[model samples]
Target chain A: MAMLTDLLVISAANRIIGLIRDVFVALDPDTAQAVEVLLYFLVMVLYAILCELLLNGQTLGKRIFKLRVVDASGLRLEPSQVIIRNLLRLVDGLPMFYLLGGITCLLNTRMQRLGDIAASTVVVRIPEVSHPDLDNVLGSKYNSLLEHRHLCARLRQRVTPEVAAIALEALTRRDRLDPVARLKVFAGLAAHFRELVDFPAAATESLGDEQYVRNVVEILYRAG
Target chain B: MLIDLPRFVNAERPHWQALEAILKRFENDPDLRLPIDEAQRFHYLYQRTGSALSRISTFASEPELKQYLEWLVSRAYSIIHGQAERRRFHPWRWFTVTLPTTFRRRIQAFQMSLALTVLGALFGVIALAIDPEAKSALMPFSHLTGRPSERVAQENADRGKRLEGRKTTFSASLMTHNTKVAIFTMGLGISYGLGTIVLLFYNGVILGAVAFDYVMDGQTIFLLGWLLPHGVIEIPAILLGGQAGFIIAHALIGWGDRRITRAQRIREAAPDIVTIIAGAGVFLIWAGIVEAFFSQYHEPVVPYGIKIAFGCVEFAGLIFFLWKGGANSEQNNSSKA
Candidate 1:
């Protein structure tokens, strides 16, 4: 879109300049060429400036890809930063393709191009409409399990977020497991959680391996 | 008692779907007003989703469902916490103030760049004078002119021809070409500045040889008239590109201070680098126009003496700009601020 606008600006300006020069000064061939070069340069530079200013750092292509240009530090995007980055685009889009820019992105932790590095800006993938399955399982935000204070206190001391993630993964992907695999997995998890604290025998007595995992998850993540 | 998983999922599906609808509404248009009741419902559903994500780990819930809630919550969190305000653009302040200030601050880097280029040019002149056949392994510009100045001189005498007065690429194409070459000088400098080193040397070599060609043909005075019309600005612009390239190479090689990471150094150097290179690109645009329209007016349209005189003025103007332009502005800025 930037290039398109640049092209339009150049054509429009050229025609207007031509009309005035012809009517007044009678542009020689040399003068006409000079005017063309000047207009092309102005349009090339201004296209980027105008597009970024109007669209908040999103050009036509960026908008199409659902990518947004934002400050890396999460500060509001500043015009100076935008100008710096857009100027550096000449460097990033080099050697026929974005080969240099691509290599830079691969090397940098934030995947920044030269312009991005200069501007302290990043191109982020906008978050999209997400799936609905989580609401079904964690229904109505009620964690009655929290009301069981003794069990909750025990669970907290035993479970870390990472370990709980493992338990969650195993349970959610249970259908993918072999019957024998499921039994061994749950048994190992039950042993792991049990080792964290010496819970009363009453909590363990009625629960099998799978039920033990579920009860532990409920206790660990219950709403406050 | 063990819960019937499928039965529970059936009963819970509507609430999950409803929560998704609310989050989507907010995500689609962050400023879209939500009534008080709907807002409370959205918050309630968000909390429920968070709780489900935690417990579903052990519930044998579908993996896809878990992923869905994870994404939804993360999206919601970003929307709530992230600053997404549209930025107001200020073209005047940035170009006039910030850019010049950076240019002034990076004077030393540009000096280093100038020193390197002069060294390369000296290398080209001396090496070619000694052995025209002695070619650097990487010499792309040599084909334009270099080494066999005697041969080019002979051809020029025999044909009574020179590239002077000959039209080159169209004005726009020439500007584009110059811009690409200058930008590449800065970009490829990342290879420990080696690419920049070679390219600069190669350019100087080509230039030295071209001069040799004209001189051997006994057209030194005329060539000066032709080249200086645009070279006054064009040469400096290319040199500015070389300076920017060296700055990038220095950042990559960790020649800079170690208090900051290499990335941070690049960030610091970038404004100055951009200021010079952008200036270079703008210069090339003017150079292209001159080469197309004025530089060619050497023999007939304009006298050679006057063209040479015009070139001298352009060169003197350039010298004044570079010598004092950045320094004066920096002083002015400090005083103003």
Candidate 2:
């Protein structure tokens, strides 16, 4: 995601630069050619240095591809390495297509292209996950097991950590289990704690066994 | 700290269960509220939920469960951010990304300018060839032609003596005339494309007539000496100036009434105008240099050959450097996105 954003930004910037160059040329065709050549050289140098050094070896294009360039030791790449990697772009672009480099990425486990290998960089997806409000968990717009606030409060107080852990494990493994098997696992866990808590015999059926187990754990934890 | 247990239970069993346990334990814990920035919050959510969510396909057999899970996620997001609505999409942001790509794609206009100039020059030559009398007809003065041969020789001798004596004034007048001509060519090039064509046509006709006049007078050699030195740069510079005019005119027309908002058009046209003005400056400067130096030097064969060589080099260089399509490999890569 970060790589995609960075690539989009860089692409936008490149277009602005190209437009400026065009205006210069339009103003004076005779001198615009020289200005264009100079501008191209400058842009190339800037791309190599900024992308390789400051950006940790990820050009806008590379970033969009969810890749980064790092040294052999998995550290930020050096300026010389960045230059070499970029210069090698011409080579990677050889043989009439990007076939050579594209094939390398396809075969590699980490998806490192020639440029990545040369610059010693790898691209990894960065994930995000952290919710701050625990109170809203039971009251969540998504929860349906406990409809009333009082019922949710009562269940939160009765739930226990052990039951919560078991419920989480069961839920995580739920995909591999048949519906009957999944219910059995939740019922079994709920049964272990049923003696310590007051609840209806059919509570596990109305409230999904997973939800039942989770409610038991939440109630126990709140009480403790 | 109020918990809506019903909605949580209605969500996908796995996510709901996992979330329920966490929320129940931390429900009343004030210390769980970490005062982190929004970016950090998003990052944390992405890391935790992305991994967990990736483990299971959210395609539940129960439609209510699927809807509940979607609602739960969205509600959680809203609670964290304090906003249920997404930010509005600003078109300018997209324009910024796309505008540059569009401007750089104007190699077509440059090619058109080159083609028009060449065609105009070609037609001018053809027109001059079809009308032999047109050359003398266009000349402003005809009284000097009525004099006898000897009298004309005497008059030329006297005028040459006078010109030698007042060299500074004569040179100043010539400079003034050249400056006026160059300026006129540059300024008139802005008449949509017509002005540029007219400039090219007139310049071409003048060139053909001068050459033809010298040939008729049996002084073709002298004509070559008189014109070639400066005509090389002068002619091309005039054509370029005219081309710049055509570019500006085309840009104005191309930006015509479109659904694109007014503000967007302004932003788009600003850069184009800047480029055209800059190019015009270059053309003017080159014209000044050629007029002051080359045009002043009325040498024989050497100067003529040098001028012709410069013209050939300029033509070839423009074609080579501005050779569209293949030069934009970097752009091609960016465009793939």
Candidate 3:
């Protein structure tokens, strides 16, 4: 994100300077030619200083990518830290194309550029999120196993939480699976449950693989 | 009666949704402020979501709810803990402490660059002495054609003067030019340091040949007077660039700790690499000022001895400061830092 903004700032400055130079060349060629390099350097320095100060730890590019500059402790980024990092950015930008900074970033576990290390700042990813609907997975209420509340309690004691969650997810996602896949998934889940609990043969005799899974979900979540 | 799964979800779903809502707002706007009630509720919901995740992961059949809560909790954690109101520090400390310390760490790389420049200069001088008529080949006259060097040499031969009133403008341009060169030298270390070496050697050869050219032309006094003032500062500035370049090269080649990846070691040394480059930049600017205004304009007006003496002083001061200025405490704090 930071790199993109830097490019924009540099190119914009160049265009503005180029226009002024054209005017100067027509008016005072010598003066314009002499100050060209100086003008560009000053603009570049000012660009770096102003962008960091005004943006509050985010460059135009950084904001676009949802990456923010923060202190190492995951706290607020300090202005000094920002300066240190940016100052070092010149070094990182050496030989063109941030090759030095890129190498450093790839090496470090934190993915910090040269500036990031000196300033004790980190670039963190701020992910976009939304509310997830629960109706599809939690809508069902009927449970044939409700008659065996005591048995459900025993099953809960025997089945660990991890095993129960897996069973529920498979059952919720049952309709999405192909018939062959559905049967295989249920068989594996049933075998896993059977290992955890020794249910009576009479309870299981008539139950298909999907029905057996449904009964397990009922016993775990619906039965008291 | 069967335990009502929907009823259980009904009780907890509002909390999860509320948490999600506040976190979503923060994600969109990091600086956004929530109402006092919402702020406290946000924290409360985060805690609830954490507990709910463990619970759902254990007993609940609603995997999606557990997943939702987990995502909300993590986002909340990033916001609540990361929204730090920034503090300020002394900027001077960065140059005084951090920069010098970092440069000091890579002293070996600087030395290597210095050696290359010096060797190149010696080679040029030797090559020129072996054949005085080699001036055309030795000097970069092809590049100098119509450039400032050609004009400056012509004027100096006539009136022993050049760049009289345009010193500031020229210095500014030279400063920019030198800085670019220095930075380029430091940055090219990634190419196995090959580019850096070639640049340093090429620059050294130019300086050496130029020195020999002035000697042969009987302009030795004028050349010394011209180059010393700025060369004292400028030469070291370029050398520092070479040092920084070599530092990058060192990192690339994996100078230490085979157990860790080469890139990791380079990251560890990134601070030093930048510090050296920055210090070099400062010197280059100073050198440019001396070159455009002081050195080039000093001849006839300023005695050659005075000019050379001034150059020597600047050079000696640089060496002293680089070697001894912050050595005492750096030795003690080196490992800790």
Candidate 4:
């Protein structure tokens, strides 16, 4: 929905700009030729500048919707990559409104539009909340109900220092993990902690080990 | 954390009763917010959901996991879809990348078009040389006969005397005629192949006959003065246009007895056709400028040399630049595979 809206906005902007340029040229025949050439160069330059600076490496519409452009590895996109991707829009938009491009994107695993395939970039949503920020729940209004530092010490007793450390590290660097690896690490830690806490099987399964681990951390932080 | 216990527990399960007992204990303890351990547990559960969702391959047949899977899928879909929306409208970055590639491709196509045109021209000249009588058959006799030639000479002298009064209609008429001829030469290529050949032959015969007439009229100097100035650029443009026509024909007609679908052939040929048309436009523009300004009033010696130099440049430029397809390196690597 956001991507579609962004596209609409950009298309509208393009049409408006084109109309303005046309009107400017029509006012003076001799000057119109010169203006036409100048406008073409100007439009190209403006497009580059707007995309690089304002969009977080995305174009104006992209920035508005909190979308980010990244490389195949999901790192920040390079300017050249951005350029290549945008330029391939011609191919994407070829023979009409991106029919070929849309097909290519549908066929690809990454769901790359024509430009993305050509430029080798991916568009991904920036996570709204980082894992570490979950710790802040302890400091919120619920602090009186739970103690954080004592719970951390209790957690330390339940699990080896090394295991706790690994869990903390995994959460801190969650972004680095592929989805599968992240799940495995989190699930393993949760299950281990659940055994130490000796929660009933019914509670353990329903809440799940991973959720249980998160609840412990949050409760401890609030109590601190 | 306000855990939604009812949503997760199956009422019929014996374990659900035990889970409710534990939940009741926590509920009675007014100070018991979710434990830190519990929060960590939930976090891990969320991560598991993400992982399971990501491993779409494993869940292909697991109908029981559909609801959980749908949740995960929707979240990921929203993220990606949102990102796409943001980037869709702002094509400047994409345009930057695409424009240069398009430009380079177009330029390369133009060069190929030029080379093919020269080859076509050479073939037409050969055809003319082989059948000299065809040259006379194609030539415009009104411009060549003694009385008409003498009358033209008188008119030229009168025009020179009253230079400012001379009508530009003559130049306009010539322009119109040349443009029509060029278009016919190019457009007939659509007739599969024969039309292109005929166009090429007609052009070659006319050029040869014109040269022959000038040489016979003891006005070789005048002919050089008149034709050389614009012929240099104009002739190559026409020849290149002819070449573009020939390429279109070749693309339409498969080279050998390979069974290829017409649609497949057209798709493969689309890029070349676009390139040819673009090249033709450029050539026509250059031809117009040359004929309008330079051809009508240039010194014989300089114009003749310019004409020869222009032809050589066309030949060298095309051969050096466009013959190697851009995918050659990729092909080499792929062959190793």
Best by TM-score: 1
Instruction: For residues A106-185, write the lDDT of model 3, one tens digit per residue.
Output: 99999988667655667877555432233455456454555565666556656765777777778778889999999999
Cα lDDT for residue B88, candidate 4:
35
The model with the greater DockQ, 2 or 3, is: 3
Report the number of clashing residue pairs per model.
3, 54, 5, 52
Listed in order, the DockQ scores are 0.10, 0.02, 0.17, 0.02
Clashing pairs in model 3, backbone N/Cα/C closer than 3 A? A1-A61, A1-A62, A76-B84, A107-B263, A161-B58
User: Which candidate comes out best when scored by DockQ?
Assistant: 3
Model 1 chain B worst lDDT window (10 residues): B160-169
Q: What is the lDDT of residue B156 in candidate 3?
A: 53
Q: Each prediction's Cα lDDT score? A: 0.64, 0.46, 0.70, 0.48
- Over A1-224, each residue of candidate 2 has an lDDT whose tens digit, in order, gives 54456546656666776787678766664355444444444454356556645554456665566555544333223343454345444434445455766777899887765545534445543122232233533333343333344644544444443445455556556678998888789778767655544454444445655666656544432221
Which segments of model 1 are wrong by more than 4 Å?
A: A1-135, A138-147, A153-158, A197-199, A221-223, B1-104, B132-169, B250-256, B259-264, B326-329
Give TM-scores of the second chain, every candidate. 0.64, 0.44, 0.71, 0.48
lDDT of 1 by residue, B1-337 (tens): 2333345556766777888787667545435567789878877777777776665544322445566667666655555444445334355554555445555566666676666667766776676567765544324554544444454345345342343332333666677778767876765566567777777766776666566556656777667867889888787778777777777777666663888876566555655676667777878888887876677555544667887888899888766665555565578867999
What's the DockQ of model 3? Answer: 0.17
Evaluated at residue B5, the lDDT of candidate 2 is: 33
Judge the docking of candidate 3 as incorrect, acceptable, medium or high: incorrect
* Model 4 CA lDDT for position B249: 54
lDDT tens digits, residue span B105-166, model 4: 44533354445445544654565467655554555565554433564366345433432322
Query: How good is model 2 by TM-score?
Result: 0.31
lDDT of 2 at B88: 38
